[model samples]
Target chain A: MRLTYVFIAATMLLVHLSASGQSQEIPSVPLKALTGKHFDTVQFNERENPVILSFWATWCGPCLKELDAINDVYADWQEETGVELYAISTDDSRGIKRVKPLVNGKGWEFEVLLDENQDFQRKMNVVAMPTVLVVYKGKIIYQHTSYVPGSENKLYEKILEYSK
Target chain B: MVKKTGLLFLGLTLISNLSNAQISGSLESTGQRYVDDNKIQLDGEDAEHRYRSNSYLKLDYITGSWSFGVQGESYLPLSLLNYNPELKGVDIGTVYARYSNKKLGLDVTAGHFYEQFGSGLILRSWEDRQLGINNAILGGRVEYAPADALTFTFLGGRQRVGLGFDLSKGTLYGANIEAGLSDILAISTVDISFGLSYVGRYEDYEHRYLNGNNAHLVNSYSGRLSVSKGGFYSEIEYVHKGKDLLMNMGAPLIDGNKKAGNAFLLDLGYARKGLGVNASLRRMENMRFYSQHDLDGNVFNRGVVNYVPALTKQYDYALQNIYVYQAQPQYQTTPKIAAGEIGGQLDLYYKFKKNSALGGKYGTQVALNTSYWGGLDIEGDPETGMYTTKALGFGDKYYNDMAVEVRKKWSKNWSSVFMYLNQHYNRGYIEGKGGMVNATTATAETTYKFGKSQSIRMEGQHQWVKDNFKNWAAATVEYGLDQHWSFYVHDSYNYGLDKIHYYNLGASFSKNSSRVALSYGRQRGGLLCVGGVCRMVTEAAGFTLYVSTSF
Candidate 1:
């Protein structure tokens, strides 16, 4: 019976691999919004505008620093480039409680998503925390990992590049 | 025949849906070939399974508001050295079906799920592969929001203890309700919310010493209230537990009542413009509650019914992580005394002007953090299993840390970060090794961007201590080309411990959501931690490889 299950799993993997030849976008997964709504990654926008997804966790000190830096200039960036920033929290059940309180406390201005299982983070092949990636028109335009204090400015530059 | 047909039918249906649906998943496989190491034991006879591999394949099918996912894991022959051999095998790890409707304000998940309530002080169900812990409940969960201001969540199921389905069964169930008063009151000046949660765990079997009469059903309750207005915010949570007999009362021969346990947590923050300050405080006594009756906290963190972790800073630097504080989950059951802990942490962050004297070119960021925790002043008689404390009075200090960090960018292409940390760790009380050790660590990291798609980063760190591995130094350099290739070399030298050098060289390549890494390294055998949870990391000399891909 276990062998049967393995065969079925392998078959599914092969089938899915064949279908994965197309252009890459953000990983298609359902994550909860801070407002208790589930959002599909593929249906992000009505148009192919640039979308910046920054994967972070509450326990990650660098991630919070980067997010806080971006939060300071977030409004200006959004106004200029019309780029939507998704601060994706990869914190699981243990740290999920801190997310809401911290978000509200910090008064962040980005759309917050919960990847409690890290399904989206795993699909995106994020190797480390504080990974910021820009996706536009079904293609990954830019990605940067391991944020230093001033690394957020580089992310803004990439966002502007993709917005254009 | 019927089972095979059913599986085939399911596979075909999923495969057919893959043609049009947006299906994404990931596969991660980590393989290691171990060699004998002098520091960590590996050769006598138990090391027959010299090759260890841990692999996970996850598939998520998301169609609009509905999502179905499955995870399969394989630990061939043996799991990691830290992981129990009983968990070695290939099996379907988890499978779940979930549906969410924005219009109805409802979300539901069935089969297997993870959940938490209010900082996880009372309840938390999660999975951490590196820690070899996956306490995801095999059950059903529902979240409902009748209005935008109110939300309710409920879950009930047995926890997955080991690889198989029918092993050492235990049940965990919880429900939480939260309501935002400002939204319901139609006011914007003040934002207030309150939540209440109840969690219960039951297992038929109990430790022989603890006696089968140990409360078959244990309950924990939590209440939280949060208030935020303008730049000021504060949140508090209080948890109370019913009588739990599974707890060790100074070697299990206690005669009297082990009535209840309690914890109180408070978090306050104020952030406005470029300045932010936050503080957290917690007091807990006899709060190490588990689902089953196994002592010493179950290996791999399984059967943990509640989560209470260290409130100290989780440092990212290597040396800063050496003296990390772990929450005292279990009461100190020594012949001398028995007590819990009371502790807190404070953080202050400020940024200077971009062109100011202190800020230089890109601006300066200064962060100061301090945290400390100590055992409570309580005395317990083994015969009675009772203790008294001086009402929030702190006893001997268990651990404390002070840190300051400064970050500045010199130019568009160059950036630097410097950090210093001083820590005092009571190993006797915390880790049960050296008596007490004081350490100071300093680290400097620099990053230079060469071109639009090329960058190099390097870091140097050193720690000085008077005892226990007196001094340590680590250095790492990494070069990366935007999204395709990254190579890194790192070495950490322990000057005191036989002058061993833990070294590694690795490179990773990623394109369009798939990545593979190869490395040869020597790992230091010690306690590796994840979110305040600690597990043994065996010293190893090996060649390692990792592959992760998403489809």
Candidate 2:
């Protein structure tokens, strides 16, 4: 009976280790670290703010609409719950030039990041554009693919639910 | 003596555990048999076997902030060239190293990466498995952001060639900076942002074939802007390039001309409540947006893309797609041309309330989309000019496509959708330089669902041609068992000048984290178009299997 107990405990430990291995926590590297820029880190662990990460390209029509819809209400959300939205452009060097002009012209006020090499996209396992991931407390809580009308509202609700 | 025995037992146990970490992989093979009854070409039966098998081993070990993992994949006798049995060999697909720190807000990646710039006009490095297109960069990249409104990235690498075809080791480099100025430029009803980027490439070419060993520099600069207020939004982009623009006329061409080109695009849209509308226009001149000056065919050239033209008609029916519009890069060089041609597209959608009798119990959604696209001559000569500056009317020139769709839900678990399309395709405009027009096509499709997991989709298509194949028809039926599994059978019959029937049947299975699909089909000779470029795929009867997994 004693030997069986030891075997059971050992099996449980092994199972726990394997499960943890598959569920890797989302990396919290500073945006500068990924871009090869030097900057001071601003950690936001205490506030537990919900983070919206969107992968898009300038050439995708659906992506443009999705971002425009969110930009319409990004300010109100910030005032209410301090949510941070990161709009990552997967534009290559050729299209990279349009990123600034297009973003500035559209009047979007969210955080912008350039994944010129798609390193972040590959890590997050993104296969298509207009992919959105919602993170809470540095862990991915929800993810949605593609976009249609009124989807932004549903995303806003998810953010509000998690923030509270 | 007891301590030695204990150590030996421990050593044996470790060895057994290591052996249990199995190194296993998978193999997928396909074979095709083609039969042709043609008078012009030798006709009979030809059989070929094409197989692609990939194997990799993953080992995981973690220590502190560092974790290590490696994956290796090889294609034995790369299946892409299987149609031509003469080429056969093993090729490496990918290998990489990645590291991330949870505490330092740092993630570093060195090795190969796949990336893209906005819409890929100026720069896009990506891969499409079905098309066998992989443009991953062999280089290093780092990203960092410390503020809510600012982000920066610096990247440098070499463009990817095909497997075992990385000879012309040209250098590609670029950097991007984006800033969100909403707080700095405050407006209650508006938000604004800006970005700047530059990309340059160096290539060494021995034009010995063209008779010179000249090195050229390919540079591109792009700028974009967007504005939205209430229900209206607009976006504009401008791209400029230096001399020796690498343009892919979809065929072989010389590269050593001091030619420069520019392109501008505008998209305007409006959406409110149950209605939406959008319009777009683009004009380009001498723009050949290629990363390498010496390359013949690149989808994204610095000047303008000729194959993947923007569609006013996104034909979903198979027949309509057969004769789709393609871009013409040669039109940019007309000596008599004045202003570059301009093209535009429009889309609209509306919804009806459910209480209405026509909408039934669950309300109906109706959408009407129509688009007309044509080229302008600018100042080109009538006889020798590449393009004329004539305004594209309902049936004037270039291409015109119109489509309408109606969708409705009958009950809690039932819904249906119907669509119809009409198109006019000009072979001359679509084929570019010395290409001819083949025919015009019309098509329709319908889909019905029973409950959430079971559904059937059907499509019908037809083409009416003045010449060439004359007419064609196709139909397909699809059934879905659940979210993870779907089965479909389809057949396309040509019944005009020559009678030929092509049939295909396939099934796809999926479970949590993995998917496997198998299909057996006969493909008739035809043009397949994506975006705006078109390619002629051979006629064949074959079997295919695809598998994918994620963790």
Candidate 3:
């Protein structure tokens, strides 16, 4: 078993050296849209402009605040940068039922997907809620964790830098 | 010599092909150092270990349609207080390899995997580190999406219950199928979907109490339907479980105590633009199912086969969380012989338009939520262990909560949130002690942003209760130095009785996908919940360090 692990490690290292900066592709985990339609997250990379995936939950206070702040300026940002944002809810069965009503109640316009078992979250290596990532052509360019009061602006700045 | 040369060539070829693979992984470690304090003292084994840590590292390598991964975990010396004692030492916790082909409409996984079927009433295998519940299955799973509107899944495995791939004796098998009826029928006006699921658990018993009538297989089946048109939607689910042996205090009773279980859940919602309303009603009776029969009703929530979280409005403030509710789905005969619980919750969300009376210069968001739960009315003979319950009735009040919240932004630099809540918590029934306590709580939070990326937030909260822990007051202040750094100081005082101050101060730094946080504080011993699932944590004064990074 130890020798097998060594061999696997060597293969991973070789792959790492070859793939280097070109990897970081968005995983193709299966997901469900708020409308209950099947969705493949890999489709995110096929978009023309940079896409943002925000992992959040209905019960997380900071996540709500962050999304609300971004919602305020989302229209303007989209018109300017032609960017899109996907609010990926990691609410398991307990809270998954409330996500749609809450999102609609808040009047958020971003596309929403459900990660019922958090498979998409785990595949993305997200350890915490309110983790936002910027991807262009399936490759991650920027990411951030947690949220402060005025942190949305910094995120927008990164979006602008990547959009151009 | 010839075989060695062939093997070397094969290795070279494999290495060259894997060069196209991409690797991603994450690491998280949390360490704590306990301190001796007069107010809160550690006892027994807890005192023996002054330092403890829990760490996990996961690595995934993907190439085209094939991907592989492994998760290694370490709980050295000791894991965090309240964690499962079985989860000790370092070992490979989970391993998996998968092949997914979107074009072929097929996905297969061998090793450890997580899954959920139809709201997880019958089957759900997932992980929650905070709650110390990682019951992923170690076996095989296959998913086939033959068409855009139809999908089927099948799985069989043994549940992991401890560290280092430890598995439960009982074997689990499940099958599920979902169909989008609207799309198949070419109905454009409304959307309709349907699903069916079945889960079975098999275990061999060798105890003398067993009888010829006892069966090793326990089967559960579920049916679901959902319909939506425009902004209106509704979903309904029903589950029936075959008769199985009943357990009392983690031990199986006589075969005569075998009982069957069932559950019903309904959800309705309507939303558009600025207004949204949703309500959910659920009833569960003897619905607790576990991977291992002997491990039933365990404190660590291990070897669980389904997800049954409390349906309540999860609070954001510490005071509001004190009287949180946990789902009651077990049958008990001590003190009260109750079977299960029935309850529902309603939520309403409305946004006041901008430049209006309630909106001022900016819009204001208002949310109102309420929930109530009660025990199932059951009539039975304790000696015979036979019980009968009505389809719908409240035996005893378990919990109730009503809350209102408003969020507003006065300006670009200033924002605030205010909330008020009322609760009725039955301590005696829920926690096995004390009596009913009525409580009311209110909180206010305000944030002021200055400079380019700096902000300050202050919050005040107060809870009024006449029994069980009495009244409490708390306050918090957080300062953000920049986009990547922040500091916070929080204190919750039990002025009504204990006269103890649970003070905590913490700072965090984050850059990209990495975060580091350090804190020194007195942990308030109680149930710490995430996503409505909870774990009991002991009171302790300590310094904690947390670090996480992903690449």
Candidate 4:
């Protein structure tokens, strides 16, 4: 029995090591250079300003609300703390046509990127819509899933704290 | 030997550039154990165990203006992945190559890709892993944006079939155009957006059951408007589509005839300080949204939607969801089928704070929510055969719900919440495929936290009704050790609902990155309704284990 226990413990330790190894394997790719007319990437490490990368879909109600709330004060935030907000739309081709119109309809003035294939979503470990990630110098400082009415304000405060 | 040598050379090149590339993957597996009691079908084999597993690998290589990647997935137990056994070992995943430059954007995927058109009424290529749904298109896509607010896409491909099933011999072509009118118009407070799309498909079927054309066409249009100032915001969306509709009322009907449907959704909300209020109304007609034209023998291919209003009250209680409203396409015809037809739902939510001395150690927050859903009778009824011009106020079938929730935090590490719900469900209206009649239910739950890393949740729910299997009580206890490790146990007792109906207990353990759960309990078989569509799940004793993660 004791030997069996030892064997199990050893196997578990090996699994843990392998899992952690993958995290370390993340390549050091620069974000600023991911530029194309239809897509753009921002490096959290390269920017002195705090960064907000939000993953959303046009059909997701909570995601729309979160973006709308931020749009209301996005200009003010940009003026106050030089923050760069990047809204990534996970709208597949069927709904892709509405992204620009919806963004314009909301009067939102933020950088936008398209993850039509969910490539970035998978890389970022997004399980649900309206997932917000606050990054500073390429490191994820804070992350939150789902959104309530006033959650955007809390996120702004975190951004300010981190940027400072 | 030459091909192997070339692969070796490519592998060597990958290793040389390994320092600049990123590779990651994830694996998720689920297992189910079903125990059949001879209650429904006595004198037959009544127990089985099933297991399902799905995994994916993603690798990305980045260099300056270009990035390349591929994602591959495999599913087991053909049916679990919604695959027909006729086609074996045919994994329905994707592989792709992409290149982007300042002036051009190009994407070529040989395997599968999910696409959608505005609001997904006419087209929506998506995947819901939990539901084993993946509607990817195996094709190539290209996008061009000449201006900041305007974009366009051209795509051609074939839709994904079941896991391990080869793609059907069909081809689909589509295009989308989106523009922001606000950029050109002087709209300060009002934001307006519009989208237009067209999809054409060609099917090579051995047996053309529906229309002899062997070709399908769909046109979709969508628009949205929003106006916000101060703490008030209002937004509305409208979508319309024209395409072939498939109906399965028992006997399948392939309606190649042109059908049109539309939906309108409006939301208005206000919040300031600790107070919040929101109200919403939605009306939809003939909106059985699907991409395929000839979807025969597909159990879930019915396009009819269950209409439920987005009410402030949440029906999270298990009993409330048991007999919830589901959309029925067969009985509830859209305006296109019957003149002046309409269906809509309404919801309202409000929150309040308590500061009285009786509130004790901590202040309290309370919320109330209520919602109602019904259909409009516009034209002739099968029963009355009267074509009165006046519109019917509301259909006899409806769903009404009211709920209240309270929360309080005692110190930094402790918090608790209490909730109660009351619901009235119309079976005939909600469940299109008839079964039982109308029913009512009530439920309550509470949760408490011990610390940041440790917490416990408890729930008690009960329902009183006149139906044969109506009365029920349930309890659930859950403990969390950190965000990664947690365990939960729940049981429900249905007294005298049926001779075989008894109690069920289930437990689950999960880590942040992985999970394994086993449940052995008696599930009450009933109509699970959403939006107005209902699916019947059999009552059985079973255990299920599900695991998933990403690297």
TM-score of chain A of each: 0.82, 0.76, 0.87, 0.78
Name the better of 1 and 3 by lDDT: 3
Off by over 4 Å in 3: A1-19, B1-18
- Ranking of all predicted structures according to lDDT, beginning with the best and ending with the worst: 3, 1, 2, 4
The better-scoring model by DockQ among 2 and 3 is 3
**lDDT tens digits, residues B230-270, model 3?**
99999999999889887777766665368999999999999
Candidate 2 stretches with Cα past 4 Å from truth are A1-22, A26-121, A124-164, B1-73, B81-90, B98-108, B144-146, B164-168, B183-186, B208-215, B245-256, B298-314, B329-341, B376-396, B432-453, B530-534
Encode model 2's per-residue lDDT on B1-551: one tens digit a residue.
Answer: 22332333244334434543211111223323333334212133222333443322222333345443333333443443222222234333343455655444344556665544444555666544333445666677664544545656567777656443342356777666566565345554754555566667777766533356343666777776656666676767777755553233432234333455566677777765556666777665555444455444443222121122454444545666666665433334422233334566676666665588775665566656655555554544344333334333222256666767675556543445566666666665455443334454554554455653466666676766666567888888877665456788988788887677777898876542345678887666656544344455556556666654333
Q: Which candidate is the best by lDDT?
A: 3
Clashing pairs in 3: none
Predicted structure 3: lDDT: 0.88
For model 2 the TM-score comes to: 0.69
The order of the candidates by TM-score, greatest first, is: 3, 1, 4, 2
Candidate 4 C-alpha lDDT tens digits along B1-551: 22332343245244434564443444555555555555532123222214444544333444544455444354433333222333222232555555555444333334455565554544556655544445667778776666545667778887666543345455677788766566557555545555666665555543344456433455555665655555566667776655434333322234422345666666666544445555666555555544344453244432211122232232455666665654332223322223222343333322232356534454455556566666645454444322332333554445666666565555534555566666666564444444344455544444444543465667777777677456777777766554434566666667646544445554444333344556665666665433222345555555566654443
Tens digit per residue, CA lDDT, model 2, A22-135:
333453333322122322222423237888888887656458657866876789999887899888787543234345444544556786777655655655555555777776
Q: How accurate is candidate 2 locally (lDDT)?
A: 0.53
lDDT of 1 at B465: 92
Q: Candidate 4, which CAPRI tier?
A: incorrect
Off by over 4 Å in 1: A1-43, A46-48, A58-80, A91-164, B1-14, B17-20, B37-41, B63-65, B166-168, B206-212, B249-257
